[model samples]
Target: MSAWPDSSSIPASETAVANKSEGKSTDEKPSKGNREQIQVNPKVFNGETQIEVDGITVDLRNRYLAALLAWLVPGAGHFYQGRHTKGTLFVISVLSIWMLGFALGGFHVVYASWYPGDKRWHYVLQAGVGSAALPALVQGNRMRLATDERGRTRSDYEPLWNGFMAPPHRPVLESEADEVAAWYARRGSGYEMGTWYTMIAGLLNFLVVYDAFGGPLAVPISGRKKRKSDSSASSSDTGEASAFADAV
Candidate 1:
């Protein structure tokens, strides 16, 4: 038997398929629209997030996890994503605001109270701060059934943290026993200030979480506008030059 198979024995159709599989090809090129989209491997941001956009792989580091972390603690998502600078700034700013507000209100600013007059509308906004406001929920649950005489509403029965985030008693309930009244007397508008501050912190955290999940804007607003202006200026200059040449 021959050591090598004869070339003539191989079918032409089979030969062509083999040649294609072997990667020997003509000069024909794939159309641009049909070309695969560019994918960026995570590197610059030092994260695991792989992006399909060109020049925009900030390495979001698992957007959902980052978002959850950010929600749990302000700036945590950015930290996970290797964005230390932003993470530090967010942690400082958000925690500072939340702490200041909580202290200003004597730790009563973040309670989740939905009882009648104590609508606790402020808690809705305060919840945005995440964990800083979460203890209120725990405190609320602990003291949920601890009501007063006549099964009436009250903020008594101090629970965890000495009733720190407990619901406020109705103002018309009675005298010195009412926590809300006591808070009003002691803080004197501090409650309002603290509520606003914590709410702001929570709102800020919301923004931070979104940033971690969505990465930075593709093109900066200012940069995009600048590019458009520069392009228009160049176009006008070209038009003027053409007019001058025709006149000349």
Candidate 2:
């Protein structure tokens, strides 16, 4: 045998076989190439997909229903529209403040010389009546617009009520009526203030409603672009196979 593998070089268990094979016929001998190993790259698998969602539109009918209900009753709109807590609170707050003002101001307005039975008391009475009713009416009108079924605003109705179809003109002040009318005029100021206050209050309520129900029709979401794969990296399968052989 010419330079056959030594006992220490070949494993001890294989030494016996190597010596035996060294002296055997070439056709029956096993070559070193038979013991050589090969490795293959491993592959990574990912499971991901892209999808979309349909858009949602606003519901005008529901808004209108809330507004209408509120108009009919002090806070009925909120209540009917599934806002019972706010509706109840608003109705109670307005009514309580108004009634308290009346009670404190006296069932009758106190003036210089006129008694409760005097005609002068009529001015004060009218003032009280207006103060209580004006705010409610103003709020009702605003609520109607705020919660419109068609999502229409107050400006839509302004053309009809504030323009050509407006209510009849105010009565002219005659010369003789000025003195007594002045007192009533002052009294009318109370309703004016009430109207303004109610307008503000109603607007605030509208804001609250907007906060509760406001949202855009819908927004589109785009899918992420695919990333480019690296061309130089070895196969993950080869790594896995080598790891498995090492483990074994």
Candidate 3:
């Protein structure tokens, strides 16, 4: 027969097995709790649609519509996406800047015109603001219709379009050239500022459009990595504290 195991070894072996079982139960408790927690709050782990509009729940699965609405009207996409605060702020700020520019330059400040090479480029920027920039297109077309192919003003359209047209460039009498120069010098800076403000507003709206198309920008993080780092730091701190207590 095999030599009988030492009586003392039996208790040690039983204790080791008991500790192993206890360890397993302790580990399983946390996993079970985690599963229950996940079941209770699934949204935290699984993505869900949660957009609401005007006190009514709505599905925002169609990103294209949101982007189109955003482009058509500043902040509108955010509004539709249930981001009321951002939408309101965008609408107020962008529309205010655009309106201020319009007021400063009148209808003349915002319209599209290609005849003057420098003027057409501004319309490209301004058009980003959507319907707000359309009046300029209408006025530009009306102005075109008011002029004949020979570059002479048509009498029938002149009365309606004269106020909207840029002053014609004509051979200035030497005596009056100084007066024309003075007038332009005084008004040029104001017009330039108004154009800049309007264009900037449109450019800003372009960003808003993109933001609406994509969900709000957020910083990304690896949750698992973060938790591991936190646990390691906590364990180190605990070891240091235990050593200090032993020294005391």
Candidate 4:
């Protein structure tokens, strides 16, 4: 047999030309594993661009849980969201402040007194009264912040506030509290109603607290919604950059 020259014997330019002429593709398809690699670009916000983590998306997983948790215990919602330290701190702060106020502010007397006028005035005064209301308010505000949807706090969305704004002359609890206090002062039936009102307020507080911190995680309704890229979507949104693209 005649000796054949090895490929190395060919000139580099000739080899490249030969490879190209043979229908060889320079752009090889990546392997399956390699195809999994994703490159996200930096997010743009208000004319500023910042990099962030590549894979994480907005997770509305436990909104109800957060609310429920907050209702059950002051900062439970935060704790449920993998923020144990924050949750505990919130609970401690709200509860401590409320409790301390009650201990010092004669809350029990306010609640137990039967004068309708006294009860009404007491509620207004005790707006700073119970540890319950403040914590509930805190939890509700937290839920509003933590929740993904924007219109959740709209009073129109709530049945309790439907058709009840200024000029409607709706019977607000404050007015009722005053009525109850006056009624009791006059030895009328307002006493029981005032007590019941207080109880209902407490219960409402519980629910709000639970929802704020311990409500069930609300799953994203759509695949796209699940993939939110807003700056508020992640804990690391501020003060960091990453090699990822966010399409928000």
Which number leads on lDDT? 1
Per-residue lDDT tens digits of candidate 1, residues 142-165? 655776555454544557676667
Model 1 off-target regions past 4 Å? 1-48, 51-56, 153-156, 169-177, 220-248
In candidate 4, stretches whose alpha carbon ends up further than 4 angstroms from where it belongs are 1-60, 107-115, 121-248
Each model's C-alpha lDDT?
Answer: 0.71, 0.37, 0.61, 0.41
Can you give the lDDT of residue 31 in candidate 2? Answer: 81
Task: Identify the leading candidate in terms of TM-score.
Answer: 1
Task: In model 4, state the lDDT of residue 25.
Answer: 64
RMSD of each: 15.0, 26.2, 14.4, 19.4
Candidate 2: regions farther than 4 A off: 1-61, 95-170, 174-195, 208-248
Q: After best superposition, candidate 2 residue 246: deviation in angstroms? A: 65
Residues 66-171, model 2: lDDT tens digits: 5544443455555554445666775676455544433333321212112211223223332232224333234334434443444333343432323221211122
Clashes of each: 0, 10, 1, 44
lDDT of 4 at 105: 29
> Distance from true position, residue 169, model 4, in Å?
31
